[model samples]
Target chain A: MVLVAIILSACAPGTPDEDSWRVDALRSIGDVSSSVSSVQLALQHHDRLFGPYLQTVAVQAEDAAGTASTKLSAVQPPEPYQGRSDTVTSALDDAESLLTDARIAVVRRDSAAYADLVRRLKRTGDRLSRIEDRIRALPDDRSRP
Target chain B: MKKLLNVALGVLTAIGGFVDIGDLVTNAQVGARFGLSLAWVTLLGVVGIIVFAEMSGRIAAVSGRATFDLVRERLGPAMGMANLLGSMGVTLLTYVAEIGGVALAFQLICGVDYLLLFPFVGALVWLVLWRAKFSVIENLFGLLGLALIVFVVALLKLGPDWSQLGHSAVSFQPPKPEAWSTWAYYAVALFGAAMTPYEVFFFSSGGVEEKWGVKDIGVMRTNVLLGFPLGGVLSVAIAACTYVVFNPLSASVDTLGQVGLPVAIALGKIGLAIALLGFVAATFGAACETGLSTGYSIAQYFGWQWGKFVRTDVAARFHLVLLLSTVIALGVLATGIDPVQVTEASVVFSALALPLTYFPILVVANDRDYMGEHVNGRVLNVLAMFFMVVLTVVALAAIPLMIWTRMGA
Candidate 1:
């Protein structure tokens, strides 16, 4: 029974389940979050080849974050949950804007601008992380005893 | 039956060369993003490795020489040096990645940081290289690598849509959103992982280690014909596992733990146990293989006697290269670089280094003086030469595509 439920959940596609869209939306943001941090790791390691291509990474990351935010916002939520969804979308907005700044700073090798953006990116990352935890803890539709 | 079983070297090379750490991660990453669309690259790589491994193995059997040895004799000193430098550079990079890969695999089970496990893994690799007999090393890890078969079972249990997978395999486009560059980059990485230069160096060198003669040619053919393709299947199964589990969620696999998630989901803890065993065995086995190949390439290039079969006292240069390569690998990992990144770079670099070792081997294989009657026939030569072109194109495209895709994002 447990295995079947797991399999069914895995196979379900864009169902009308209350948390379905948010779960997928939040997870996509998490993927982008993971990719962004990997880029940061590459830079932190002073990886000359991949890390230094900051403009390209920032542009790409910005586009992904922007698109993810758009998608997350497009998903209609129940009235009571609208604020939480907006909070998540707002985090993505901050990420997208900072990534844009990161691109220019990275291109100029402007340490001050890049440092400022990094600070903002960290805060936005923290909020998105909190939102992800909240969304994951949302009750599974069928899990209610 | 016994002669067929003599394919231990081939099987060992398959486990390490064909489906090592680089292949495991790259295949899963591709599958998550591209589905089985890149499956054809794995197939192409399988055929390419068989052709070259057969030639190199035949050269060792007929000429009593390994690849680097004949590379110098046929291509002369300058070209040999270039080959040595290119091949050894990638081999050493691969050595570092393989050691780090083993550490990563062990980390999956023990929860220790891979950097901390480097010393133990490196020590174990060196110990096996130093103390274990050739056949013992080959058979032990090779058979254990069969544990990766858990992937096949998990895939079947997952019951993926076979027709959908087949359709993805036939389509040439990137799944969506991802550009042609990411697809092309991974294609080259997959190709490079499949036909990694160290595999040829290790395979030919292992042939020499076992002291194969022309009579052993049949066994070599069996290994190439049978053992290698099976290894490619292991690669595909890994990709399919990811495609089934992660593709739906749009989740990309960036870590080894996630690679095994589908197996656990399908077969529970027992499956996880077996997959982890496979990971350790495959990565540990490759570490030993690559650590030795580092020695093999340098020793063979300089005309210094080298082989695990030979005493360390007699092959001091070879053993020293092994020790130095291990230390260098440990140094790189200690810098806290991601082994997964090293794994990605190693495969792409292998694509770049392919032409260096391959061109000379093709020249040597056709030389009647070296192979006697075992020379490549006209048909096989045409096929081998064609794949050489394929390898060259992959070499040229690997770096640019990696950059354009930001290392596949």
Candidate 2:
């Protein structure tokens, strides 16, 4: 419930412009965040069956992040938000790359790698959230009817 | 004194063996979504299975015929074939799910894909079925399966508000945003998991496999009466822990990792280690039972030489079916389908197959030719008939409710 609200309130501008790249970018960021956090929670408790559970979500995160990155790659941002959109897409790609690394670390029980990946995951998540915040601050896309 | 010890061990094994992948996963899922509101279904399932297990056990002890044998004798070949096919199909589906469950549990420990473990799990199960003495298999896994009690220990460690959880248990009202259909759907799933037909098939066939006679009825009754209700407590414990952790977040449990999270959150590392052990033992133990039950139902229906009492060569057809079924289970699980989803479908389908599997037990237990003086007495008759109605409703509504809820979303 908390996660859902975080994603929705972060992604929605009063109404998004049909062409608003910010909305698409923010939504992708939210998706990556949700998937990363789920994997992160499983990892923090990494010494147990959560590893197997991580194995389950690891595959899902891989698929979801792939789609999110592909969608973000297609987005051409609006005038003021173009730079923010580029950063968001780059952060998303990094996050996706890290999730794959985390799955391998989790499977291999590479605690050092798991530790490093988790730190990177947090930085990536924070980056996504900050971009979402900036997108949330933008005024409603006035072009939508 | 020796007989008393034997009875005690039997009951303990039953208690330990009762929680399988279906119970572990379904109970945790329901608890997260509905809190204690649906706990009654697990309890109801316990009492229901006990009532019928005693009857089936009685039939096996008195007549020395396992379930499908009498099912064929009483229900006739044609209708009995329908029963056999329905029950065996779901039982095979459940068999595949149990193999996947064991693989899932192993994955938790090693951080590997469950599919990678399927062949070894299936091969180990078949090897055990082929060579292990029946009593050794029954007692070993069932006893190890008791590691599931970690859920109860974790629940106490979590120290939830009992009065609030108790109120939800009493009210039977689902939390907001959950509709009645979804609740009813899980209720059926719980029912199917608890009273799953294979447990009985394994129980009665196990009675015959161990050569239970009138001499063993006392032991069998003691196990069902005392063991099953205690097993129900472990099922509730899984739900209680999940409710404490995931309910507030409105999280629906989808992964085995989520199921063990509450345990880790409560007791941390050591608790999770034990819970993972529980996961492996419960699922592996059930894999053996369901795998055997698959072979038991088919062999008995055809009147083939069966039971571990005979040499493998003497029971060649039975052993062959067991081999083929293991391969089939391996094939199904190797397809990359989720075992958790398979468990949900198996239990719901088990609900659909319940009456077919059980109605003959009720009939055979009552028949003078089969049971003689061992037939159900008056009070037991009243209770059995009442549950028949309840199980009938559960069976009729299971499919529609599953479809309406889209497998509980």
TM-score of chain A of 1: 0.71
Candidates 1 onward: DockQ, in order: 0.04, 0.15
Estimate candidate 1's RMSD in Å. 14.5
Predicted candidate 2: what Cα RMSD to the true structure? 7.6
Q: Candidate 1 lDDT, tens digit per residue, A15-59?
A: 334666656555656765644543343233222322223343454
Lowest lDDT block of 10, candidate 2 chain A: A11-20
In model 1, which runs have C-alpha deviations exceeding 4 angstroms? A1-145, B7-17
In the predicted model 2, the residue pairs found to clash are none
Model 2: DockQ score: 0.15
Model 2: TM-score, first chain: 0.74
Task: Give the 10-residue window scoring lowest on summed lDDT in candidate 2 chain B.
Answer: B248-257
Could you tell me which residue pairs clash in candidate 1? none
| Highest DockQ scorer | 2
